[model samples]
Target: MNRSSCAIVYNGNLGSEKFLIQVRWLERTAREHGLHVQVIGNQELIPGIVDGSPVIKGRYEGQEPDFFLFWDKDIRLARHLEKMGFPLYNRASCIELCDDKIRTYEQLLNEGLRLPKTLIAPLIYETCEGIDERPYETIVQELGFPMVVKEAFGSFGEQVHLVRGWEELLPLVHRLKHRPHLFQELVKSSYGRDIRLQVVGDKVVAAMMRKSEHDFRANVTAGGRMAPYEPSEREREVAVTCARLLGADFAGVDLLFGEDGEPYVCEVNSNAHFKNIHDCTGVDVAARMLEHIMSKER
Candidate 1:
């Protein structure tokens, strides 16, 4: 039996305890599955053009893994690796779509998925001075008071904000105006709560309901509690469809509830942290991900 080899790529600078745990589990699971795995950081492996050919600076000589399990938002390296004929899980484009909130919602809306009303801020370059007050008033009029503001690229709900009225909205907007952000009507029914469904391949392997008593955002990193959840047929279909639409091998699809308990696509995470889901549901998402990779390699 020949063991498959995998290169797990991550961001060294963001090696939080939670992130490292995922990598450790992947290695342990790989060994259990009769596989060889090497952990590499995006900073260590520099992707660039050398002699007019794509090359990774820190890759060992004559060393190429059977596949790359990319766990970082470093799309450049992921793209370079894919361009060099290395199989990448989730693919670079999928990761990019998931990393940018605006892009994710755009794709979901195009597919006619239910989502909260949103307004994307205009793009302003760093070289420019700033945006006018006209758009802010327009956003306030459209989304009204108590809206959600989010930076296009962020994780763990850190970049998401809940603005109550003009006072809070203006300062927040001024601060984030230079950055890529969006305004969304708050899903009041789903306030302080949401569902996270872990999709591996075509299946929703694990799921949990996240709720925060003091916060509107339901991410565990944002002080939300997690509980095991059994999704309904509609929820399951919506999650699977979101993952498929994003061309992801696996993803964490969040569903927000409407007044009538209907599900709305919140956000899709391509390299979603599996530690919280594993702790809540006792499902080894890392092992399942490795299994999916093995199957694909075969």
Candidate 2:
């Protein structure tokens, strides 16, 4: 703790160039606050068991920083750092829960938060040949065709699908049976639209309404356009509460409009990409995040 230093654990498996840019922004922002930051990929440190205890291989051999700014969804590495007593922003549990869409909905629902009716898909091991379509009948009957099928672990709406017919669904289910997923009733009111609220330290710092006329997913990464939107008092309340409930130091909370115009939790991003927000709102989210982390360090 003598020198201000942080390690941003990022995912090396992801090849997105934007991830690299995110690291650069974070490093530059941390410097603004006089904190030295290093970007470390998960692959750099191999996890192993030593004497029947989980330990990071060669963890002590390297420069152990005072803080961990986890930018990856590698829960095991985050947990290992936590066990090593390094302060981690957002924490491993929160990142894990937020990484899995099904878990996020479940946890939020259990917290008495409103969400679109969602059904978890049955688990299918990768070793299994495939899955039967019988159980999907309940899914079809409950949510109907044109429902949303979201993979448990995904980002930027890449693994999210809009099943418009039974024919399209069976193959998707068969293809994704081995992976965890969920079916959610389509929020028609929010179809091709949603809101992204960036929450930090009890404040909704930036808000945007993402809309896509050509696609169902409103993610800017999904070709949606973002416009600065003023959230209603209730929207702000929901977004802030969602972040607090997840124990997130900062997060991008997506909210959907229910049929009755009520806001429901759509998803939470522990490592939310703020480049789009900066483009639209002209707000430097990286600076704010760095400031929030520095506050915790103090």
Clashes of each: 0, 0
User: Which parts of model 2 are misplaced by more than 4 Å?
Assistant: 49-55, 58-62
lDDT of each: 0.89, 0.87
Instruction: Write one digit per residue (lDDT tens) for candidate 2, span 1-298.
Output: 3489887777878777888888788878887888776777789877777787766665444567889888888888889878877889879999998998887877787666789889999987788895777889988999987899999998899999999998899888888888899998888889999999999888899989999999999998889999999999989999988888888999999999877868878999988999989988998888898888888789
**Model 1, 29-81: lDDT tens per residue?**
88898877788888988777878988777655347888888989999889999
Best by TM-score: 1
TM accuracy, model 2: 0.94
The estimated TM-scores of all candidates read: 0.96, 0.94
Residue 12, model 1, lDDT? 86
